[model samples]
Target chain A: MRVALCGNPNVGKTTLFNRLTRSSAPVGNWHGVTVDVIEKRITGTDVILADLPGCYSLTARSKEERITRDGVLFGGYDVVLFVAEVNNLRRNLYLLTQVLEARKKAVLIVNMLDEARGKVDLELLSTRLKIPVVGTSERAKNPKESVLEAISKANAPSLPYLNEVAADAVARRAAEKNISPEFAALKLEERDAFIADILQSESSQRGCYGCRGCDRDRPSALRYSYIDKTLDGVVSCRRRYALTDKIDKIVLGKAALPIFFLIMTAVFFVTFETAKPLSSLLGRLVSLAAEPVKNADMPEWLCGFLGDGVIGGAGAVLAFLPQVTLLFMLTMLLQDSGYMSRVAFVSDGFFKKFGLSGRAAFSLILGLGCSATAVLSTRGIAQKTARCRTAVVTPFVPCSARLGVFTAITAYFGLPAITVAALYALGFVAALGALKIMRLFRASEGEDALLMEMPPYRVPSLKRTFKAVFANVCSFAVRVGSVVLGVGAAMWLLSNFSVRYGFTGGSGSSIMSTFAGALAPIFKPLGFGDWRAVTALISGVAAKETLISVISSLGGAGEVFGSAIAAASFLIFSCLYVPCVATIAALAKETGWRYAAVSAAAHTVTAYAASLIFYQSARLAQIDMKLFVVIWSSVVFAAVAAAVAHKIYRVKKRKGGAHDSAARKERK
Target chain B: MNLSDYSLKRGVIVSVGCDDDTHRRLVDMGLIGADFYIKSRRGGAALIDYGDFSAVTRNALAREITVRER
Candidate 1:
C-alpha cells in the first residue's frame, strides 16, 4: 500500500514523515525545504509512504508547487495524509478541504499539537470535518500506529461543501463531460492547466474557471469560512509561548544583524574551543599508533610511505571530525530554532542590493559545512539565474576542509589563534564580494521574489538535532576516509617517486617537483614561488585531502613560504582560490560546465591578483627588497595582465554597443 | 494604504494591489485580507505577521499589497 503525506509549506509534514519512516529528512523552520517528493517504505509493513512537496491550495504556479499538484492528482495512493499545522488551521484547512473534495481516502493529521498551546478538541474536529483526524507530536514515539489506523478508517466527505459558483460549475461541467461531479468540480477548483487546455476550445479568452465566473477568491473565502466555523467550536488559542516572542523581538529586530554576527562568532569560538583539545588528542594517538608501523621491518621506503603518507594524511582528516561534527550541530540548531529564517529574512535587504536573495545566506551558512552540499541545497530557490549565481559563488565561503587547512597551517606556524579567526571572517567578505561582482551584468532574468514565512521561534529538539549531527558525521567520515584518503595517497606517490616509480633521493628529485618548478615563476610575485609551495597549490585543488600531506612532506608551511608576509599571502591565496573538484562537479550540475569553468577561472585569476596586491603592498611598505628582481617581475606581470583585461573589456563593449544599435534599428 | 506606507503600524489587509505571480504566492502564504502585526522594518524590507505566521517581505513586493489601518 502506498500512503502519501501532503500539506502547506513548513507545516510539519516532513517532521511527521521523519517520525513515521524513522528517516532523517532535512527539517528547517522555513518554506519550500522539501522541493522534491521523497518516498520511504514504512518498516514492518508493505506500505510505501511518499512525502510530497508542500503547496498552498493546489494552485500550482512554481515547479515545487507543480510537483505537489501532480503527485496528488496522478500518483496513485491507497491513503492520502494531509498534514496540518495545528496552530495554523485556518490556512491548513484550505488544503484539507481541497483534498477531501477530490474524494480520495484522506485523513487530516493535526501535527505539532504538543507545541500548539491552544486547546484543541480532536474528536470535535474529526466530527465537524467528518474525516479521520489524528494529532501528532514531533517527538512522538508511536506516531505511525494512529496515522496508519486513521488511514484504515478514513471518513472523508464525498464532496466538499463548495461555494455557489463551484457548485453550479460542477453540475454543468459534470453533465457535459460525463464525469463525476466531485472530480469535475475538484479539477475546476484546482484551475488545473490540463483541464483548461482540454476545455479551452469551448471556453473564450478567460480560463475555464474564470469563464465560468468562479473567481479564486470566492472558494478560498468559503474555505476560510468553513475553518472559522469549525474552529470556533473546537479550538481556542491562548498565548502559548511568550518567551518565543520576546526572543524574536531582539533576534529578528533592528539590532539583529550585528548581533547575528556576534552570535556566529560565538558559535565558532565554542565549536573550536571544545573540539580543539579532543582533535589534538586524536592526532597524538594516531601518531603513537603510526610509530609502531614505522618500526615494522618492511622496505624502508614502504615504511615511510605507510607511516607518513597513509597514516599522517588519514590522521589530519580524522582530527577535523570534531570540528565538522560541531559545525553541523550548531547550524542545525540555528535552522531548527527558527533563527536562521529570521536571519535570512532580515538579510533579504542586503543580499537583494547585491542582486541575490536573502535565501543566499542559507546556502552560505551551509557552505561552512560543505561547499558541494551547499551548492546542491539551492535547488529550492525559484529563480534560475539567481540560483545558478548563488551556487557558482558558494565555494568562496570556505568549507570544513579548508578550515582544516587553515588550522593546520596556523598551528604549524604557531601563529596566534586570531589569525585563523581572521581567515573565517575573510571567507564571508570574499563570498559576498564575489557574489556582488559576478551576479551583476547578467541580463535580467525574472528573479524569485523573497516570499518566506518567518516561522514562530521554538526550542530545537535535541534528539532530532543529535540525529542530524550523527548523520552528517557519518557522511563526512565516509567522504574523508574514501575520497580524501585516495587523493592523499596519490599525492604522496607522485611527490615521492621519479617518472619510473623509483624512490627519489628526496622530494627535490621527484616528478611532482618538475611540474611544480614550471608553475613556480607564475606565483613569484605573490611570494610563495618555491617548488614545495607550488605542489601544495596544485594538490589543494582537491583541498585538505592533499594539502596537509604534501605540505608535511615538503618540510612544512614555514620552510615553504620562508616569511610571515609570504605565508600570509599564500594562505590568503589558498583561502580564496578555486574550490575542490567535487565542488566544481556540483557547480557544473547546478549551472552548466561553461559557467562553472568561468567561475573557477575567475576565482583563480582574481585570487592571484589579490594576493599580488597584498604581498607587494606589504613588501613595499616594509622596504624589504631582498628579492628585488623577483618582486619587480610580479609587478610587471600584474600590469600586463591588467592591460590585457582592459583591452578585452573595451572590445566587448564596442561589439555590444553595435549589436544594441542594430537591434534598435530593426525594431524601428 | 500599502505595507511600505504603514512601516511601524499594524493594519488589516484591504486588498492586494497586484495580480500577477506575486498575487497567488502572497495568498498561499495567508498574507491577503487578514489582520497583520508589524514587527520590524529595515533595509527596504518589513517583517510582518498575520495572526498565525510571520513573514519578511521586500518593500518592493510589499508595495503590491495594500492594507487598512487596524
Candidate 2:
C-alpha cells in the first residue's frame, strides 16, 4: 500500500516520514525545507511512503503548495498520514480539515505533544474528528508501528462544516461528477476554478444550474469555527515558548547581525585554529604512508606514480577532513537550533536591496559547506527567477572544499585568519555583485515578497549533529578516494610523460605542461601564468580540493606562484571560477544546461577580470604609489564610462520597444 | 494605524489592506483576524506574535496591514 505524509509547514512531517520509511529526507526546524515529493519504501514492508512538501492550505498559493495539493489529491495514495503538532493545533487543523474533506482514508498524527504546556485529550479529538489520532512525543520514537497500525484502520474524516456550508453545491457536483460529496464539498469550499467551471458548464448544459453566488470566505470561516468548537475542551496549552522569546531578544534584536558575525568568527576560529594540529598530523601520516611504497624498491616510475600521484594527492585532501568536519558540525548546529532562520530574518533587509529574498540566504550559507547541495537547496525558493539567480551565484560563496587551498596559500603569506576572512568576504561580495548584475537584465520580472515564520529555538541534539557531521565527512572522503584520486593519477601521468619521450620525470616537456601552456597566456595578466598553476586550475574543475592536491604534487604553491601577489591572485581566481563538475551537474539539474553554461562562462570571465585588476594594482603599488594611483584612476574612469554607456543604450532600446508596441496597437 | 506605523507592542488586526497575492498569503498563514503582539522590528520588518506562532513580515507587507493598538 502507498501511504503519503502531508501537513502544514515545519510540523515534523518530514521527521515522521524519515522514521516511518527509514530514510533521511532533510528535516529542518524551519519552513519549506522539503519542496518536492520524495518516495521511499518502508523497511520490512510493502508500503511506500511519499513525503510531500508542507503547505498552509490545499488551495495552493506557492509552487511547493501546489506540489503538495496535487500529490495528495491525485497521487493515488492508499492512505494519507496527516501530521500536526499540538502547539497550534487550531491552525494546523485548518489544513487537516481540507485533507479530510477530500475523502481520503487518513490517520492524524499529533506530534510534539511532549513539548506542550498542557495535556491533550487524544480520545476526544479522535471521537470528534471521526478518525484515528495518535499523539507522539518530541522524538517520535517507535511511531512507525503505531502509525502503520493506525493506517490499517484509518477511515475518512467527516467534518460537519463541509455539509453545512455547501450542501447543495456538494450534492449537485457530486451527482454530476460521480465523486464523493466530501470531495465535491472541498472543491466548492476552496472555490477551485477548474472544478467550479466544469460544474457550472455541465449544469448549464441541462435546464438547471450550479450553486449561485458562492462565498469563498464563508466556507473557510465555517471550517475554522468547527475546528474551534471541536478543540474547545480537547486541547489546553500555552502557545509561546518563553525561552525562545528571551533568546530572540538578543539574537533577533537590534544587534542581531553583529552578533551573528561574531558567532561565525568564533566558529571559524574553532574550525581553523583548534583543528590545526589534527589536520597536520593527518597530513604527516598520509605522507608517511607513502614512505613504504618508496622503500619497497619497486620501479622508480611505479613508486613515484603510486606514492606521489595517488596517495600524495588524495591524502592532501583527506588531511583537511578535520577542519571540514568541524565547520559542518558547527553549521549543522546553528541550523538545528533554528538560529539560521533568524539569520535569514535579519538578512532579508539586506537581501531585498539585491533583488533576492531572505530564503536565498539559506542556499548561500549552505554554499559555504558545498555548492552542489546548496544549489539543490534552491528548491525552497518559490519564485523561479529568484531561484535561478540564487543558484547561479551560490558557487561564488566558497565551499568547504576550497578551505585547503585558502589555508595553504594564506599560511604562506603569514596571516591565515585575516586573508582567509578577506577571501570569504570577497566571495560573498562577488555573489551579491553577480546577483545585482543579473537584475539589470531581468529587472522586469516581478519578485515575490517574503513571509516566513520564525521557528522556536531548540538545543541541537549532540548525537544527531555528530551523525550528520560523520555522514558529510564520509561523503567528502569518498570524493577524495574516487574523483580526487582519479584526477590526481591522471595529472601525474600527463605531467610526468611525453609523446616524444615515453617518460621524462620532473621534466618541462611533459604532456600536461604542453596542454596547460596554451592557457598560460590568458592568465598571465593575473600574474599566475605558470603551467603548474594552470594545471592545478584545470584539475580544480574536477573538484575544488583537487587544486590543493595537484599543487602539492607539483611542488606546492610556493613553487607555482613564487610571490604573495601572485598567490593572492590565484586564490581570487580559484574562489570565483566555475564550481566543481558535480556542482555544475547539480546546477544543470536545477536550472537547465543553457543557464548553467551561461553561468559558467560568466563566472570565468568575471574571475579573470577581477584577478587581473587585483594583480596589476598590487604590482603597481609595490613599484610606485604615484603610478599606481594614476593607472587605477584611468581604469576606474573607463569602467564608469562603459557602465554609463550601457545604461543609456538599454534605456533607448526599452523606449524603442515600447514605441513599436504602441504603433502596433494603433495599427490594430 | 498601519502595522508599520503602530508604535505600541500589542495590537489587534483591523484589516489587511494588501494586494490580492499578499492578502491571500496572510490569510493562509492564519494571521488575519487575530490579536498580534509585536516582538521586534528591524529595517521596517516586524516580527509579530499571532495565533500561537511568530512571523517575520517584510516592511512593505507591514505597511499594508491595518491594526488597532491594544
Candidate 3:
C-alpha cells in the first residue's frame, strides 16, 4: 500500500517516518526542515511511505506548502497519516478538516502526547472526528504498528457545514471541470491564487469563473467554529507556566547576538582544541600504515605511488576526521535544541537590510555543513528573489570538506584558532557583502513574509545526533575511497611520470607540472603561483578534500607557499573561490544553468581580486609599515568620498526633476 | 486597531486585510476571530500566539491583521 505522512510544520512527521521506515532522514526541532517530499518503504511491510512537506491548509502559499498540497491531493497515495502535535492540535486540525472536505482517506495521529500528559482525550477526539485517532510520542515503543493499523482502516469524515448554496456551487464547479464535488468544494471555498488560476484556465473567460459570492473566509470560519465545538470537551489544557517563555526571554532578548557568538566560539574550541589529540593520533596512524610501503625494497616509482599517492593523500584528509565529526555533532545539537530558531528570529531584521530574510540564516548555517545540501534547503525560503540570492551565496561559506584544507594551511601560521576563525568570519562577511551587491541589481519583491514556527526547546536526542554525525563520517569515508583516492593516484602518476624519461618519480618536467605551469601565471599576483598550488586548486574543483590530499602529496602547505603572507593569501582565496562540482550542480538544479555558470565565474573573479589585494597589501607592509598604512588610508578615504559624492548628486538630481515637473504642471 | 498598532500584548483578531494569498494563509491558521497574544517583536517581525499555535510574521503581515486589544 502507498501511504503518505502529512501535517503542519514540526509536528514530528519526519520523526515518525524515520521510525516506521528505518531510515535516517534529517529531523530538526524547527519548521521547514523537510522542504521536499521524501519516500521510503516500511521496514517489513510492502508499504511505500512518502513524507510530504508541512502545510497550514490545502490552500498552498509557499513553495513547500504547494509541494505538500499537490502530493497529498494527487500523489495517488492509498492513505495519509495526518500527524498533529498535541500542543497545537487545534490549528493542525484546520488542515485535517480541509483534507476531509477534499474526501481524502486520512488517519489522525496526535503526536507529542507525552507533553500532553493525559490532557487530551483521544477517545473523545476520535468519536467527534469520526476517524481513527492514535496518540503517540517520540518515546512510543511501537507507534508504527498502531499507525499502520489505523491506516488500513482509514476513512474520510463528513464536514457537515457545506450549506446548500455552497453544495450547489461545488456541484456546478465539479460538473464544469469534471472533478469530484469534494475537491470542488475545497477549491471553490478557499479560492486561493492557485485555484483561481486553475479556474481562469478552465474557462477562457475574462471574468471570475464558476463561483460568485462564495466568501473566502466563510469556509474557514465555519470549520474553525466546528473545530472549537469538537475540541471543547476533547481537550482540557491546564494553564501551566511555560518554561519556553522563560527561555525565550533570555534567548531572544537583547543579548541574543552575543550569546550566539559565544556559543559558536565554544563550538570552534571543541572542534579544534579538544579534538586536537584525536586528530594527531589519526594522523600518526595514517603515517604508520604507509610506513611499510616506504620501507619495502621495491621500484622507486611503485614505492612513491603506494606510500605517497594512495595512502599519503587519502590519509592527510582522513586525519581531520575528528574535527569534522565534532563540528557536525555540535551543529546538530544547536539545531535540535531549538536555539537555531531564536537565532533566525533575532537575525531577521539585520538580514533584511542586506535583502535577505531571517530564513537565510538556516541555509547559511547548513552551508557550514554542506553547500550542496544547504542550497537545496533554500527552497524553504518564501520569496523567489531571496531564495535565488541565498543559493548564489551559500558556496561562499566554507563547507566541512574545506575544513582540512583550512586547518593544514593555517597550521603554517601557528595561530590555528585565530586565523581559522578570521577566515570563517571573512567568509560570512563576503557572503553578506555579495548579497548587498546583489540587492543593487534585483529590486525588492516587497517585504518577504516570515511566518516561522518557534518550537519549544527540547533536549536534543542523542540517537539522532550520533546518527547525523555518523552519516557525515560515512560520506567523508566514501569520498576518501572514491574521489580522493582517484584524484590522489592520478595526480601522483602525472607528477611522477615524464614523456621522455618514462618514470622520473618527481614533479620535474612531468605532465602535471607542464599543465599546472600553464595555469600558474594567472595566480602569480596572489603570491602562491607555483605549479603545485595550481594543481591542488584544479583538483579542488573536483572535491575540496582532494585539494588537501593533492597538497599533501605535493608536500605540505609549508612547502607549497613558503612564506606566511603567501599562505594567508592562499587561505583567503580558498575561502572565497568556487565550491566543488557537487555544489555547483546543486546550485544549477535549484536555480538554473545560466545562474550557476554566472555565479561560479563571479566567485572566481571575486576571489582572485581579493587575494591579489591581500597579497599586495601584505607585501607592502613587509617592505614599509608606514607606506602600507598610508595606502590603506587613501583607499578608505576615497571610497567614502565617492559614496558621499554619489548621494549628493542623486539628491540634487531628484530636486531638479521635481522642480521641472512642477514647472511643466503649472504651464499645463 | 491593526496588530502592528496594538500596544497591548493580548488581543482578539478582528479581521485580516492582507492580499488574497496572505489573508488566506492567516485565515487557514485560524487567526480570525480568535484570541491573539503577541509573544515578542524583533526586526519588524512579531511572534504571535493564536488559538493553539504560535507563528512569527513580518511587520507587513502584522499591519494587515486587524485586532482588538483584550
CA RMSD per model (angstroms):
6.0, 5.2, 2.9
Worst 10 residues of 3 chain A by lDDT: A204-213
The better candidate by lDDT, 1 or 2, is 2
What are the per-residue Cα lDDT tens digits for candidate 3 across A1-668? 99889999999999899889987888898888898999999988999999999888887767888899888767888888999999887889988987887678889999988777338889999988889999888876868788888988899877777543245654665557544575565556566556546544343211233231237667787888889888997888555327777888787777878888999999988888888888878888988999999789999888889988999999999999989999999999999998988878888889989887888999999999999989988988878888889999999998998888888667646755788888888889989988989989987787775467778878888988898789779998999999999998899899888888788766569999898989999999999999988998989899999988998887777888888889889888888898899999999988899889978988898889889999999999989999999999999999999999999999999999999999999999
lDDT of 2 by residue, A1-668 (tens): 99999998999887777777766567677887787889999888898999999887776666677788878877889999988888888889888887787778889999987778677999999999898999996564667788878989999866676556445655776677655566555555545544556566343322111222235445566777888899989977555688999999998887898999999899888989998889889989988998898677788878888888888888888888888999999898998899998888888878888887688899999899999988988877767888899999999999999988888777756655778888889899999999999987877244455577888897887866776787788888988988888898899889989999978885789999898988899889999989989999999999999898888777777888999899999999999998899999989998999989988998898889889989999988999999999988998999999999999999999999999999999999
Residue runs of model 1 more than 4 Å from their true location after superposition: A154-156, A162-214, A443-450, A499-501, A505-511, A514-517, A530-546, A553-555, A559-562, A625-668
Residues A43-109, candidate 1: write the lDDT tens digits: 7777899999888766676567777877876677777899998888888887777776655678999
Q: Sort by DockQ, best first: what order?
A: 3, 1, 2
State every prediction's TM-score relative to the real structure: 0.86, 0.89, 0.94
DockQ scores of all models, one per candidate: 0.49, 0.39, 0.53
Give lDDT tens digits, candidate 3, residues B1-70: 8888889989898777666566667777777778977778887887776746666788887777778866
lDDT by candidate, in order shown: 0.75, 0.82, 0.83
Off by over 4 Å in 3: A163-179, A199-214, A646-668
Rank ordering of all candidates by TM-score, starting from the highest = 3, 2, 1
